[model samples]
Target: MTLAHQTLALQTLGLSKSFGGFRANSDISLCVARGARHALIGPNGAGKTTFINLLTGVVPATSGTVRLLDEDVTRVSQQGRVKRGMARTYQINQLFADLTPIETVGLAIAEREGAGARWWSRVGQNSAVVDEAEALLTRMKLGEVMMWRTATLPYGKQRLLEIALAMACKPKLLLLDEPAAGVPEDERHDVLDSVEALPQDVTVLLIEHDMELVFSFADRISVLVQGQLFAEGGVEEISTDPRVKAVYLGEDAHV
Candidate 1:
C-alpha cells in the first residue's frame, strides 16, 4: 500500500480547540502533501489562529493529533517543532528592533549551524554562517537593507525579513500566517512571489484572507467556516464554490 502510506508533510486528525465553553476549532482533519502549495481561508473568528496555534503548539488541542512527515508530534513543544524542520511567520512581524537585518538573520543562521553559543568570535571565523545569512536575505529580496536596523524597515520589508529569518532555519514545512497582512497591495505581490518561489522541498501551508494572493499562490484551497471545514478543492473549484461565495458575501476578494 505504498500509495496509502504516502506520508504527508503535515497532517492533523480530529484537531479541536476550545476556550471557556466556546469551541474555536472542531474535529478538524487535514493534510498538506509534500511540496504542496496549500492555502487555508475562512471568515474572521473562524478559528484560523486557533488552528495554527494548535499546529505550532501555541495551545494544546482539546483533542486530536498532529503529524509531521508521518511522525506524531501532537505533544511537541514549539521549539521542539522548530528543531524538527518546522518554521512559521506571523501576521505581525516579531523582530528584534535593535538588531540589523544581517545580524538578525545571522543569529538564526548561527543557531541553525550550532554556532550560536560561539557567536562572540569574529564574524570572519564564521564565514559559512555569514554566507548563508546573506544568501537567505538575498533570496528573500532583503539584501539591499541587510545591514539596516529591523525597527527602521518598512512594514513590508519587515514581513520579508521575518520570512528570511524563518527560512534561515531551513524548514521542511513552512507555515505562513498571513504574510501579506497589513502590506500595501502594491508591495504584497512581491512578498508573495518570493514565497511562491521557494524550493519544492519546502512545503507551504498558507493562512490568508487575500483571495487573490491565495489563488495565485495555492495549488489547492480549503475553506473553513465557523470553526469547521466547509469546502476544499483546487483554485477553480474553490473560486466558484457557492458556499464559499456565500461566506464572503460582498467581499470582492473572496474569490
Candidate 2:
C-alpha cells in the first residue's frame, strides 16, 4: 500500500523512556502508515510494553515527540488521547466482570458518542447508543451472545470483546498490546481472524511475540532490541534480517 497520500496514524521521533537510570526505550523513531497493520516484536524485557505505555500516556516519556494524525499527543492524558481517536486494549483483560457483553460495548459506544452525561437513561431506551453497540457486536460476530456476562466468556472470547470495545471508540489508530497473547493454540487463529476483519480505515499497531500471527497480519514489522529499533521492513525483510534473527528469532532464523 502506498503511504504517500495517507496521513500517518502514529509517529515518534527520538523517543526515549527510562525507569530511574535505566532506559527502557531510547531514541526510538517509527511511523505507522495510516490504516496500516504494523507490528512491534521483541523478546521479554525488550521494553515493548514500556514503549506502548509511553505512547498511550500511561507512562511519561523521558524525551521525544509523539504525533497522532499530525497532532502532538506525547503528553496527552489517556482519556484525552482516547477522545482524540486513539484507543488501546491491555495485554490482560480489563473488562468489568458483572457487565454483559452488550452493556460493556454499549458503555464504550456511549463514551465515544458522548452519551455518558445521560448514562442514567435506560439502556434499551438509548436507541442511538444501543443500535451502535448492536452493530459493533454484530460486526464482531458476538451479537448472539451479547447478553452474556463478560466473566463467563472464555479467555479468547474476552480478548475479542476487548477489541470490540476498542472498536466502539471508532479510533483512527488502535494500539493492540499482544492481542493474541495467552490464547490456546487452537483458538489463536480465530483471534487473529477477528483482528484481520476490522475495518481497513482503523490503522493498527500491534506488539506481539507470536511470529506466525505477526507475519500474517502486519503490513510492516519493526524489531526492537535494547530500547533501540533494530530494523524496519516488510515481513520477509524483517524475517531475514540477520540482526533480528540473532536477537529474537533465534533457532528458527529463516522464518
Candidate 3:
C-alpha cells in the first residue's frame, strides 16, 4: 500500500479558502493515490468540510492547484469534476423522499447512461436501467428494501441508498462525506459493510467523525486542524501522535 510510486487520483498543493478576513482553509497540500482509501478527520471547526468543498470545486480556492489523474483541474467546475470521475455524498442524505430506493437509483443510472431526458417516460419500460439499478442496490445489500420509499426506510438504509446512488455514477474517485453520520447504532454494521465492499479500483476520500469507522476503513489519513494539515500518516502513526491526540482525538481516542 505504499503510495510513493502509485498513480494519484487527486493532488492539491497549497489549497486555501478564505471569505473576507476569515480563512476557512489554509494551504492544504495532499495526495490521494489511485484506489487509495483515504480519510480526512479533524475536530469541529477544523475545516475538514471546507477542504472537501474546495477539493470538489463546490467552492473556489483562494490559492493553489488541484490535479486529477495528473491533469490540472484547479479551475474545473463542480459538475466538470463529476465528469472527470469524481462523485460525492453529503453529511446529510440528499434523496427523493418519496422515491423507492430502486426508482432513485434507476434515475441515477438513467442519468449516467444519458437517458435522463426521458427518465419519466423510461421508468418500468427500460429493462437495462431497471436491471442496473437492481444490481447496484443488491450489491449494497439493499435489495430487500428496493421498493420501500426512502423516507420510510431506517436511517441506516437511507444512507446505504445514498451510497448506491453515488456508485451509479461509476466514478473512479468517490468522496463520501460522513456516510455513517446518522445511522442508529444497531444498524451501523450494514452501512460499514457496504462501504468496505466498494470496488477496489474506485478510490475513496471520506470526511468522517466516527473514529472506529475511520480507523477500520482508511488505509491512509490526513488530519486537518484550522484548515491546515496537522498530521499525515498510516493508522499507527496517527493513532500515536501526541499532537493529533491533543488537537482532535483527545485523550480517549483508541488511536
Residues 1-255 of candidate 3 have per-residue lDDT tens digits of: 434534899889999899888999988899998999999999999887888888789888999998887778899998788778888898998899998999999987887877878735747788999999999999898999999988999889899988998899889989999999988888988999899999999999989998999999999999988878999999989888888888764766645
lDDT of 1 by residue, 1-255 (tens): 445436588889999998989999999999898889999999999999999899988999999999987778999998888888889988888899999999998888888877888846875478888888888888888999988889999888999988888899899999999998899877777788888788889999999998888998899999898899989999999999877897888566455
Worst 10 residues of 2 by lDDT: 1-10
Pairs that collide in candidate 1 are none
* Candidate models: Cα lDDT each: 0.88, 0.88, 0.88
Output candidate 3 Cα RMSD: 3.1
lDDT of 2 by residue, 1-255 (tens): 335424788989999998889999999999998989999998888889899888889988999999888889988898889999999988999999999989999888887778876846777788988888998888877787789988998888888898999988999999998898898877777688889998899999989988988998898999888889988999999988787887874767655
How far residue 29's Cα lies from its native spot in candidate 2, in Å, is 1.1
The list of candidate 1 runs beyond 4 A from truth reads: 1-5, 119-124, 250-255
Reference-based TM-score of each model: 0.93, 0.93, 0.92
lDDT of 1: 0.88
Prediction RMSDs, each to the true structure: 2.6, 2.8, 3.1
TM-score of 1: 0.93
TM-score of 2: 0.93
